[model samples]
Target: MTEPPFELEPIGEVRTPFETSDEAPRQGLEGEEPTHGEIVLAPAFEPGLEGIEDGETVDVLWIADEADRSVLRVRDGERGVFSTRSPHRPNPICVTTCRVRAVDGRRLAVSGVDMLDGSPVVDLKAPLE
Candidate 1:
């Protein structure tokens, strides 16, 4: 049976130089420079940013809304969405583990970002070692 659809409110949004998925690095580690991006948190979520420090690594959960959710197969049509890192999938949820560079109130400067510009940030968590 199919599950009921649900909605999620974004606590923040991603800001990056990449304007299109084609231009973004396939992975955050692909390049030294392309790994840079920022997390712009909403004012209401500002207080929640209290303990996040500059030197810590965090898991950034975002919504890749621009990606084609209808795509189930990719890479020569052999790999299923669940087996590949392709952003196109049944659900366009994307996650990136990144090191914090700086934090200014509700904005966080991070390194190792692979998601597109304006991607909605659903949540942030400490990355497991």
Candidate 2:
């Protein structure tokens, strides 16, 4: 038997103008309107972000709370959650590339975002890699 993947908790929430997926941009990298959001890292994980803003862009890891995560067949029905950009799916976790636009104290100002309002932010790292 194989061990299942470990559970992950959200470190913070992603703030955006979008309250629903119907309004969220399809691709986060395609937008460059200088949108900014906060990455309130969990107080316990604050140390992990030390010296993280050394680049102009970064990768944001988050959970897709809106994903359906029920159906398995993806050939039909809007290509199912797996094939569709819809965040509702079996693996709700998602990552997007965002410009670091600016870094202020324990919060980060990011651009090129496509996430929903109050979405959980799991992790962030410089996109230099």
Candidate 3:
């Protein structure tokens, strides 16, 4: 028998100008004008914000909560979810790297965001060199 799925809680949410999914850019840093956004960390996760500052680039990992998780293939072929950047996936975990414009308390201001407003953030990591 398979083990029960693990529960993953959101650490925060992305605040962006894109109110609807269609309004968001398909990819960060490309195919759209420069955009700005903020990551609002939950009170309990505030400590995780330490060391994050301006001029740094971070990879924001988030859950595409509105995506259709049932989608197993896309692009009019039998392409697996892992082969595409399609949000509709089995897990819907997405990543976008943005440059930090500022950091205030628990809020991180960033640029080149492609995520929709109110996207639940799962984690943050420094981009690989």
Q: State the C-alpha lDDT per candidate.
A: 0.87, 0.73, 0.89
Which residue segments of model 1 deviate by more than 4 Å? Answer: 1-3
TM-score of each: 0.90, 0.80, 0.91
RMSD in order of candidates: 2.5, 3.0, 2.3
Q: lDDT of candidate 3?
A: 0.89
Give residue 85's error in model 2 in angstroms: 4.2
Specify the highest-TM-score model's number.
3
Angstrom error at residue 4, model 3: 3.9
Candidate 1's TM-score reads 0.90
Write one digit per residue (lDDT tens) for candidate 2, span 9-61. Answer: 88877788788778788767686555566666667776776776634777888
Please give the range of 10 consecutive residues that has the lowest summed lDDT in model 3: 26-35
What's model 3's lDDT at 97? Answer: 89
Candidate with better lDDT, 1 vs 3 = 3
Q: Which stretches of candidate 3 lie over 4 Å from their true place?
A: 1-3
List where candidate 2 sits over 4 angstroms from the true fold.
1-5, 74-85
| Clash counts for the predictions, in order | 1, 7, 0
Give the alpha carbon lDDT tens digit for every residue of 18-109 in model 1: 89878788778557664789999999999988899998988999998878889988988888889987788888888888889999999999
Q: How are the candidates ranked when ordered by lDDT, highest leading?
A: 3, 1, 2
